[model samples]
Target: MTQLQKQRILVVDDEQAMRELLTDLFEDAGYEVSTAADSFSMNRALEEKPCALVILDLRLKGEDGLMLARELRKDSSIPIMMLTGKGDETDRILGLELAADDYLMKPFNNRELLARVRAMLRRTTELSLPQIRKEDSYSHQRYSFDHWVLDLTSRELFGPDGAVESLTYAEFGLLEVFVQSPNRALSRDQLLELSRGIEADVFDRTIDVLILRLRRKIEPNPKQPRYIRTERGLGYIFTAAVTQC
Candidate 1:
């Protein structure tokens, strides 16, 4: 019988105690775990191997986890879950805005933490799988809208002039949902459910933050979005006509 390899998770924290705690926690939960105390080591670990998810401490001794998350999101779609001792709403929102997939405060329940980690990994795996288009009986890899092309296979967004715009995993997922359901007002909850799934422990603001990020990438003027428009009380709608290719 072939045994499946365990999924790997990287835990980044400045405190040795916290790192060891998480290492033990995840190892007990049947995941292959690695620990890093700083950004340098974290980057090196990721470079040397692939990780299914990252658990980052928001407050590091000499590093900023939010900045690290931003840098990570620039190139990789690896899911990130942030931990903070502080319960400041602003910091939480800022972390989400920078593309951190999940956030948890200190004194978190071990069970809840594990559950969230599982949810994130499951969502990542689901998104990576090829989807069969029911309408055409063939998979469509690219979606074109308003002179922009979103290639699902490549996970790249190409601008009108042929330049490529960088999109975080969350950004790409939200954009995918919008392009697929064009002209419909999707509530924040619906958007979150469609993009991340029903099991995601995300707030409504997370969707709003992702929408803002997508507008910045795809809108001619994010201030006055032409494609993703807001509905007074309903939610948001993608006004562009999308064509699958």
Candidate 2:
């Protein structure tokens, strides 16, 4: 019998000992592990093969891992677990603020690290699954709202002029939650759970950022959003009528 292929994980740290440690640790747990010492090598590894998650060190030789995390967010929704040193709470907070999936301090227990990795991988898989429509028989499905159409299958958005507007994975996930729960005021906590499936580490700013990005694409006037509206002290709500077909 052929052995099952393992999910690939990229570990980026400038320390050779830490890199070797994680490579051995994850590989022992049946993961195909890869290591990079810095952003350049990390990018090259990502370009060469798909990685399910990245374990990055907050302090690199000359590069800021936080900035690298931000760049990764712009292009991919791959789960990121930041590794921080002692007394680095400020950078940890900034990492969460920048929308990292989770974080772990240096000298973390191997058991806890393994658990977090499994949990994050599960959430990533959940978010990547295509939502099931009521009528599964329909092949090309779309959700229409306020002159904008979201193709559920392709996960693409179309403007009133019928031009396709590109959407990142995070933007699409948050929009899917809002559209499905139209006219309901969803709090940051609720949005986190509904959108990402991992709520413990989620921050309010992350949800706010996703909402702003979605409004730019779906709202006629993003400055005065007609679709997604803020509820002051409450949260946000989708006001337009959403029709799925």
Candidate 3:
């Protein structure tokens, strides 16, 4: 049997030991690994390498990891797992709100870290596949879901007061997929296939991050997302009915 190919992982930390340790661990487990000490190095590596998952440290000297994650979320659907010493629940929540797919506290078990990394990579792979649909076959009606209106023609996501909010290409793709298949459960695998373009190497849990971004822009209460409903293990569903334009 051909061994399954390993995905590349980027480890960003100011601490040299942590970066080296994670690099060794991931490499030992069959993954290609890269390390970055700060945002500048991270950007340089990102440009030179292709990573399916990023294990990031939230605290950095210049440009915090959270800010970096936000910037990354703006362009790519790269899965992010934040590593930090922060033990506060509030910090974890904030990390999630900022689009970190998972949070790992400092001094976490190595085995547990590997497990979470594997799980995150797997989930992202399932969400990054390309999905097919008839060209121009999809249509959406402008309607109120939470505070935003869906404009199919403009392909724009609007805020509650009809204001335009910044949405990255990945986020727009996710929203279109959900709106096109409203009330239907879209599995992570399905989403991954549909969302990742032919040449894109990024994974799908980026889908979840994009969804969170969309909800933050539209939903009055992101915790209780009115439009994009989590379907537990199945993935997600646009619970709010859409009227086709």
For every candidate in turn, the CA RMSD to the true structure comes to 3.4, 4.1, 8.6
TM-score against truth, every candidate: 0.86, 0.75, 0.60
- Candidate 2: residue 82 Cα off by (Å): 3.6
lDDT of all predictions, in order shown?
0.86, 0.80, 0.73
- Tens digit of lDDT per residue, candidate 3, span 54-148? 88898876667788898887777687888889777666767766766667789888887887677667656544432222134354345445456
Question: Candidate 1, overall lDDT?
Answer: 0.86
List model 1 lDDT by residue over 28-58, tens digit each.
8889888998999999999998899999999
- Please report how far candidate 1 places residue 115 from its true position, in Å: 2.3
Please estimate how well model 3 matches the true structure, expressed as its whole-model Cα lDDT.
Answer: 0.73
TM-score computed on alpha carbons, candidate 2 = 0.75
Q: Clashes in each model (backbone N, CA, C under 3 Å)?
A: 0, 0, 12
Clashing pairs in 2: none
Order the numbered candidates by lDDT, best leading: 1, 2, 3
TM-score winner between candidates 1 and 2: 1
Superposed Cα RMSD, model 3:
8.6
